[model samples]
Target: MKVKSATPVDIFSLTDQGDALAVRLQMLMPGASRHHRPKPFIEIAQSSFRSGHRCIFICSTGIVIRALAPVLRDKYRDPAVIVIDQSGNYVIPLLSGHEGGAVAFAHDIAQAISAQCVVTSAMDYSRPIYTIGMGCERGCPLAFLQPLFEQVCREMDAAVTDSAVTDSAVTYSGLASIDLKADEAGLLELSKSLNLELHLFSAIELRQVEHLLSEKSEIVFKEVGCYGVAEAAALCCATKLTGMPAELALPKQKNARATIAVARSYAP
Candidate 1:
């Protein structure tokens, strides 16, 4: 199923940087209003809660928790709440994770701003997580990488025939590659475009998943010390994310300058 547009959002910020970030987020969220350094914060929070508005707090998680403590009802009745740090490095689903759609909203916000969604909800543990693994020629241009990435995503969308799986279910949670590619411009740009963290694994780390690779390449091994870059990195990252073994969701797909693969895993 297609994800719905976000509901009205109330963004709370305590500092100038947080306010700026809040404003940036506001532009992306329809019907979002900004509340910079809101006085009587608890009262404002309670009012926002009563209105059933989705809330984004660009401040300390502690402050948000304290302010909202008195007003919280239950997960089913509370509105979705997200906490984003001033630096925008992380987006967290702070309350009403599943029933209120905070987890999914966190992912959407993270993707919009190139931040990582740090989802810790127990209900989220049962969902599948996808990671994209990539290998590209040094200095490969974003022009080459973006289209291939989109094509792969489209293929994944077409392949999801299960009635229970929605389009949102296949949203990629992160990108992965050998540590050697950590500075690769194209890979970095693609990760920025997707607004997902690019997790780098060492060759030794990638080797741990060699047995699961769908194809092996001696040429790649000679260069990167791993049998495969795309597939192995994908699986390795997914495993790391979920603390469980990962399977190849899409085996390596390559064009002239880049190779990409997808891996899937479940959190225990």
Candidate 2:
């Protein structure tokens, strides 16, 4: 599946405490909108839902539930719903646990606020979100690059299974590269084959992550204004997924036509 980017969040608050929490959320989540004491709470939530925004109610569950009852839709179609107390003591994911990432989002927010996260999803634990970054010559064949991904995943899976981190399986969240390769044929085909989203970052974004890479290349810097595409993209994507800088699980490995790197997130 093409995992979508984080959704725009709409936080509704009516009291001083709730408004304070909303301010914190604005800082924590980019593009998060705060609505303080809207006249009709239900209408505001419905509008946000219809517009594909995640709805977070910093009020009593009963009140939000009653207001959202009429707007409730299928889990896949409905926006994520989270409820938090005014004092920020408890954080609850009320709807769309996995499909909407309410559980994960709640955990991140709870951790930021030092509140207790109450996740009810069956598989509630957060795992590392691994990302693969690749750089290849124009028109490189998928046949040449496909086997490399399989090999990398096999090696990383073995390493993760042997580690003390949770025994749960590891999976690639997406593929990333420098913006120049946004339309590269081989990269697009590789992403399609793996059923993962492809994110392209600007040279500046990639350069910002150069310090985190296991290896840096002067040749690559002269060519693309960055030290390394594969390692830089992997580290950059990992940081985007998690709110912290990521560690390189596997440094850049290359064939005659392509280079690949892998990075994984640490749980917040």
Candidate 3:
């Protein structure tokens, strides 16, 4: 979907533990600027917020929130703020649960650190989101891809709700495809239309999740070296993103030009 890459992070660390955690996070989040002993903690944080960079504080949540509280604006405009304890045992999304993606970002950091992610967003548990995996021809037109995507979601929603009145639209957090199709224009447009990111996974990574799919196809395996692109991609990306196993909310389905599937993460 060509969404902007992650904002540069300004990580503030005050102790040996914090410094160690910062190094670990750098591997997962590139372009992160770690401040072992930046001027004053408050000054560093305020400057980061002013510059529109994500601020990661390796300290107590209360300390971070209190220090940044003066400059805090609405969540939509504020940069994401995350707090991790010095011991690195807990990761918390202190602000920007959705718009700034503090929740998901915290999960990513926790996964890398083997810590628990503390998310306060209720919808994260209640309204659960899924990823849509798709594989299509090289130059499939939007006309074919868009409608096919909608059709798959509708079918999934109906299955989940199990009601004739299932006319409500289903929401997906992101789109996924094989690494080869990472730059596919149709998938890019579909992600833009849905306002979500496109997650690309390699065939080997997709294969790792094949055992989780509802069914497998030898034809797909021969073609992609993965049992099923749609289901496998969906499951693999979800597991990677959440650091938890994911299940197919909807199994693979296809049209003349596109194959699709849906996978949902377990509630944290």
Candidate 4:
């Protein structure tokens, strides 16, 4: 899979460590333009906000709040505001969480840097959304796929157990897979059993997010024309469902007959 074109971003950093992390993020998010301790920080922030650029501030939450306060408008009109600590340990959606798409944006940044997203919006508490991606041999049976799906869901639950928000009632919104698997009986059965819609993506669509995969397989590419099936499909499906980019909640896990992965998105 090939990378997508970069999206525009404005990144502000306070300290040397923050600047360094900013540089790394700039590389990851190719559209980012960095500002390292500008003389009048508030003015620059206001400019960015007025211009409607998504902003990321690698400083204390207070600094960002103060700088953007004057330009703050209603959530429907405000640009996304994200705050990250100097160490890049946490990514928080400080403003316009739902209307401005900051919650989903924060999740994407956090996943790219392996940071934890600290989303405190009340909307997030209402059932978390997840999509499961799977790939299996031609004749794989539901008996084999069902247990693997359960195991991966358990894995997802365990992974988020220590996070800031732990929703025990997380919703498995759908199942995703390559178009080749659309006719697979096991997948059809699993979709029926779970009462979840099945989403299938072409290999070309899956390739767009190939850069985000944690693990890629040459063998899989040789067979499917994409580096991975489970992870790419899960991410593609989640992005489609939420109308926002998604992050892998769990990387690809495999058993004898099938492979599974999970992706998450916060709907705006």
Candidate 5:
């Protein structure tokens, strides 16, 4: 089968380890802007950070990677970053390798380009699971949040919920009530909240859940796919509350969605 064309929202300079790999990547993501070297890399990084791009692709050498790491960490809300060889032959998912989806992106790209994507996150490697968070910056709109999470309660009947971030600011454009069926991760702070749950599930396990949910036709998200920003919010809340390292669960495919959720323990 031909490689599926995937475009990076923001693509930085690439070494062109060789024309073959570079060309393959172009084919994968036809819309991604290209450059000869890493010159525009820094410029794009800076602009994309302030503009709220949560995911960035840095294709360069170890030196560039070192320089770009802190730049991304400091400026952006810890975007989902991917570092692939110029040849697109060897790919490395530096930060948020697992949760952020760097590994998945690399793997998918490698498959399309017929290259090698090296993804070895301890959690993913051991359990082979994929976690999805559900939310925007503060959270997703009540319209979507209400239905998606409510379904979980309708079927499960009883589920334990808590708010890890006590009084965590959950901003909403309209007036809403915290009529959740489950417990909050920390406390009932946000009047408008979601009926969400977090769990450390193996990708294999998630597939099962998706399949089971699909068979039963309980989840309306069959057409929405298993992974989305809403799923990212669930994963983010679950991991953040449980004191697990999983901030990279969602990619900043869009802006202010560029926002990051800091663990209450770590937040000021």
Candidate 6:
């Protein structure tokens, strides 16, 4: 008898068993070209989050997810994450979609692979809120968010505190919109109502994007790592409303990729 080599598998199946194969095919397909075909996973995830891909499947072993996780917008980061076992079984819920379908995904994979489903934190925690506010606009990290927690405190002080508020005050704006790590009902709704955003703390500053959202020649939104999300938000909000960035007029950042981040969040 001949012995065969072992194939690398997701074990947990964060990438859908089929999803990973699909992603790989897209790359190998002959018709798919750079200008015509969609961008690769990293760029696609970022762009998808920016362009409003609520759920994304990452094929490669969670490296992309880990890398981008730190630099994505909080409110905007609700793409359901699943890890798929290469053998088409053992799907695992790595993050997102608490009450939504992610649990179903895990169960489906478990049933198929005859593997165990492990759900911690999200499933057990009755109330775990993640507030993904906007990025700080100055040239430094989005450290301004920590102090803004006082805003939430003030709301609590005013007795307007909500039962939904469950700590985890994370912000992300300099990063991509897809880094949203909370359930859609939690972070997405809060951002819409609170008029807030979330982002990460990045080495690439935000001096230029400030000039766009300016007031009378003086830059108003002047905080560090603030421009990327602002611009992306402008683009996304526009896309949702009409599917075009022309009306939003969000100025393009020089380093479009560097605009993403991961930070504590708050709303004002």
**Each model's number of backbone clashes?**
1, 0, 0, 0, 29, 40
Cα displacement (angstroms), candidate 6, residue 24, comes to 13
Give one digit per residue, the lDDT tens place, for model 4 in 1-268: 1111122579999999999999888886656789999878889888988877889999999988888888887875677799999999999999878655577678767877888999897766233468999999899999899999988777666545534344354568889999999899999999999999899999999998785576779999999999999999998998898876566667788899999988776665
**C-alpha lDDT values of all predictions:** 0.81, 0.77, 0.74, 0.80, 0.38, 0.34
Residue 257 displacement in candidate 5 (angstroms): 21
Provide the lDDT at 194 for model 4: 96
TM-score of each: 0.53, 0.53, 0.50, 0.58, 0.44, 0.29
Best by TM-score: 4
Writing each residue's lDDT as its tens digit, candidate 6 over 130-176 gives 22223223232223433343443443323212111223332222222
lDDT of 4 at 185: 92
Model 2 weakest lDDT span, ten residues long: 1-10
Off by over 4 Å in 4: 1-127
* RMSD of every prediction: 16.7, 13.2, 15.6, 10.1, 14.7, 17.3
Candidate 5 wrongly placed segments (more than 4 Å): 1-8, 14-20, 38-40, 49-59, 74-76, 125-233, 236-268
Output the number of the lDDT-best candidate. Answer: 1
Error of 4 at 235 (Å): 0.7
Q: Which pairs of residues collide in model 2?
A: none
Model 3: per-residue Cα lDDT over 126-237, one tens digit each? 2345788888888877777888888887777654453221245666777899998977888899889888888999889898766556577898778878888888888777
The superposed Cα distance between candidate 6 and the true structure at residue 230, in angstroms, equals: 30
lDDT of 2 by residue, 227-258 (tens): 99998888788778877546566778888888
For candidate 1, give the lDDT. Answer: 0.81
lDDT score, residue 168, model 5? Answer: 28
